[model samples]
Target: MQITGVWLPIITPFKDNKLDYQSYKRLIDHYTEKGISGFIPLGTTGECPVLSDYEFEEMIEKTMEYNKNRLPVYIGVGGNCTSQVIKKIKIAEYYEIKGILSVCPYYNRPNQEGIYQHFKSIAEETPLNIIMYNIPYRTGVNMENETIYRLSEINNIAGLKDCSGNIKQTAELLMNPPKDFSILTGEDLLFFLTLTMGGQGGILSSAHLKTEQFVEVYNKIKENDLEAALKLWKPLYDFIPLLFKEPNPAPVKYCLEKLSLIDSDEVRLPLTEISDQLKDKINSIILK
Candidate 1:
């Protein structure tokens, strides 16, 4: 799976505390029309851990059903435990998922060897292709470039979701990794910078506004149109900070709900909806 292009880590919808199926269908159509490369459910942005297994499975199934093969649907099967993550991977394999986005094990604080061993085991255990997700801030464990280089040698291990804020790590991985290995930046604010620095593309939350912007950036860099590309994307760089003002999916869900894409601004616990003052700021930015 050469995971290239804008992937929205979609928000879960709710109405009267039940999963909002109809609203989800509408969002799928809207995202597809925006030229989204794929949809990732149950990710950090999707509030996946908070949802029950049935909800998780239903969201994945519904996304695939409504997409009707028009856009690829990648499922997030990551957890802190190796065995648990593998179980989820099997489920994705069962669904014939486009790709599996596995985050670096969180809260465990595994050493470099443990991290390598965990991922290596998964890559070899099955014939399924995998995308290595590296977000040290969220996970409390960082898979360095050396370990990543080692993992890159694994045939079935496909690409990486590069979310670590370290530009040096990202740039080095881009410069030295395998020909088929793709480095997709997860940072919405760094979307343009990453492409300019030679990344494949981004899995950006902010791409919701104009999906074409990142795609356009990718095209410009591909065609070597650095000047035109930079000019077009310069305005967006100013808007990203506001989009991430609070915890992720909060601000994003706010945008979607107010824009009438979803039915509610509700997010599960450990994460909450944005405040009214920030909403004013977000609206101000969107208007300008």
Candidate 2:
């Protein structure tokens, strides 16, 4: 499948500590028609680490059910344990998802060779396409472009969620990308930059808001209307950082609640609600 355009690492809606299927369905319905390229459930933005195994599977099931094949779905199936990640991939395969966004091993800080082996093992286990997620800040070990290029040789290692946080590396990869291997940014702020530099698109968390505007920016850029794309991107440029200022999903959930897209903005423990100050600031932005 082509991994392009704005893919939302969708937020899981919770109500009194339970999966809010009603709201989750609403979100799927809401975004499917918003020109979003696809959906990614059970990602970091979905609070993957905190979800129970049952909830994890349930989320995948609900996503497919609600989405109804209206758009592509890429389930986030990742863990530090290569074996465990493979197991999750098996679960995802049971569904009709387009692919899996597997993140790099975290905390273990695996070396490049180890990183390479981790993905290699996964590729061997499945026929499904894999979009390797490389967010060094979270994983604690960067998957260098060399390792990525090497992996691209493996036919099923289809793409990457490029959050390496190194523009030079990103630029180099974009300049000489492997044939049929996509490089979609995971960083929301870098959406336009990635497009300008020849990236496929982004798996953006900030896309949960301003969905059409985000799509328009990608469309404009692809159309080579840089001036028009910049016009759309400039207004969103400053506000993107605030959604992440307090941690993810919290601020995003708050905004969704304000818009009545979801019933509540409650996040699990270890990820509390946004600060009152940030809430007020976001509220003002929404009002404007």
Candidate 3:
């Protein structure tokens, strides 16, 4: 299935350093009500790297269980280690998740050929659709459009979550991508621009707040109403940068906490809660 529309690469809400599954389920139910196209549960927004193996497994299972086919779920299965990512993919295969949002290898910063071989190996290993995630700042090595196009030639290497932050590259891929390949921008701020240029949709974190507005941005574009879409996107255009002003899910979780959507704005170590000043700013925007 072509992954389309606004998807939440959902934050794994924590309470006193615990998984807070009750809040997680509640969050999922709330998003489901908002009519999101799908759910991405263990992505960067989900804080995947810090989660324990048991927590990871439980997150996937509970996400699928709660979803119960209501919407497609793509579990994040990626790392610098190809073998380990494959192992994670195998584990994901055992469950009922729809696909895997595999990211480019970070830290190691492999060359383009290495990136190609890594995902090619993954495509060979799994029957599931693979959405290659290309976030250069975090991954260190950017996967050029040449490498991306090469990967798209593979049947199961379905599409991309383009976060290269390079408008030219994103536009190039959208211009002449492989048939049936979906390009879903991972940058929440670029959601409108990406869709305007033929992206499928977004895997957005800011979406967790004004859920339907994000969806309607895409819907308005699909209806060829740029005027209407931008009207909906104007406020988001101003607000999205704040969600990342304090390093990702922290600000996102904080907004959820203030909205009473989650129990606490707790996050794993290495990722702290938002600062008091930023919290006050977010409160002003979201509460208004």
- lDDT per residue, candidate 3, 156-255, as tens digits? 9888999998999988888887788999999888899899988899999899988989988889999999999999999989999998898888998888
- Clashing residue pairs, candidate 1? none
Number of backbone collisions per candidate: 0, 0, 0
Question: Stretches of candidate 3 above 4 Å error?
Answer: none
What would the TM-score be for candidate 2 when compared with the true structure?
Answer: 0.99
Candidates ranked, most accurate by TM-score first: 2, 3, 1
The local lDDT score (0 to 100) that residue 8 gets in candidate 3 is: 87
Q: lDDT per model, in order?
A: 0.81, 0.94, 0.91
The residue pairs that clash in candidate 2, if any, are none
Q: For residue 93, what is the lDDT in candidate 3?
A: 94
Candidates 1 and 3: which is better by TM-score?
3
Per lDDT, the best of the predicted structures is 2
Candidate 1, residues 159-222, lDDT tens digits: the string is 8888878988887887776778888889887777777777777778787666677677777877
Q: Relative to the unseen true structure, what is the C-alpha lDDT of residue 29 in candidate 3, on a scale of 0 to 100?
A: 90
List runs of model 1 lying over 4 Å from the truth.
none
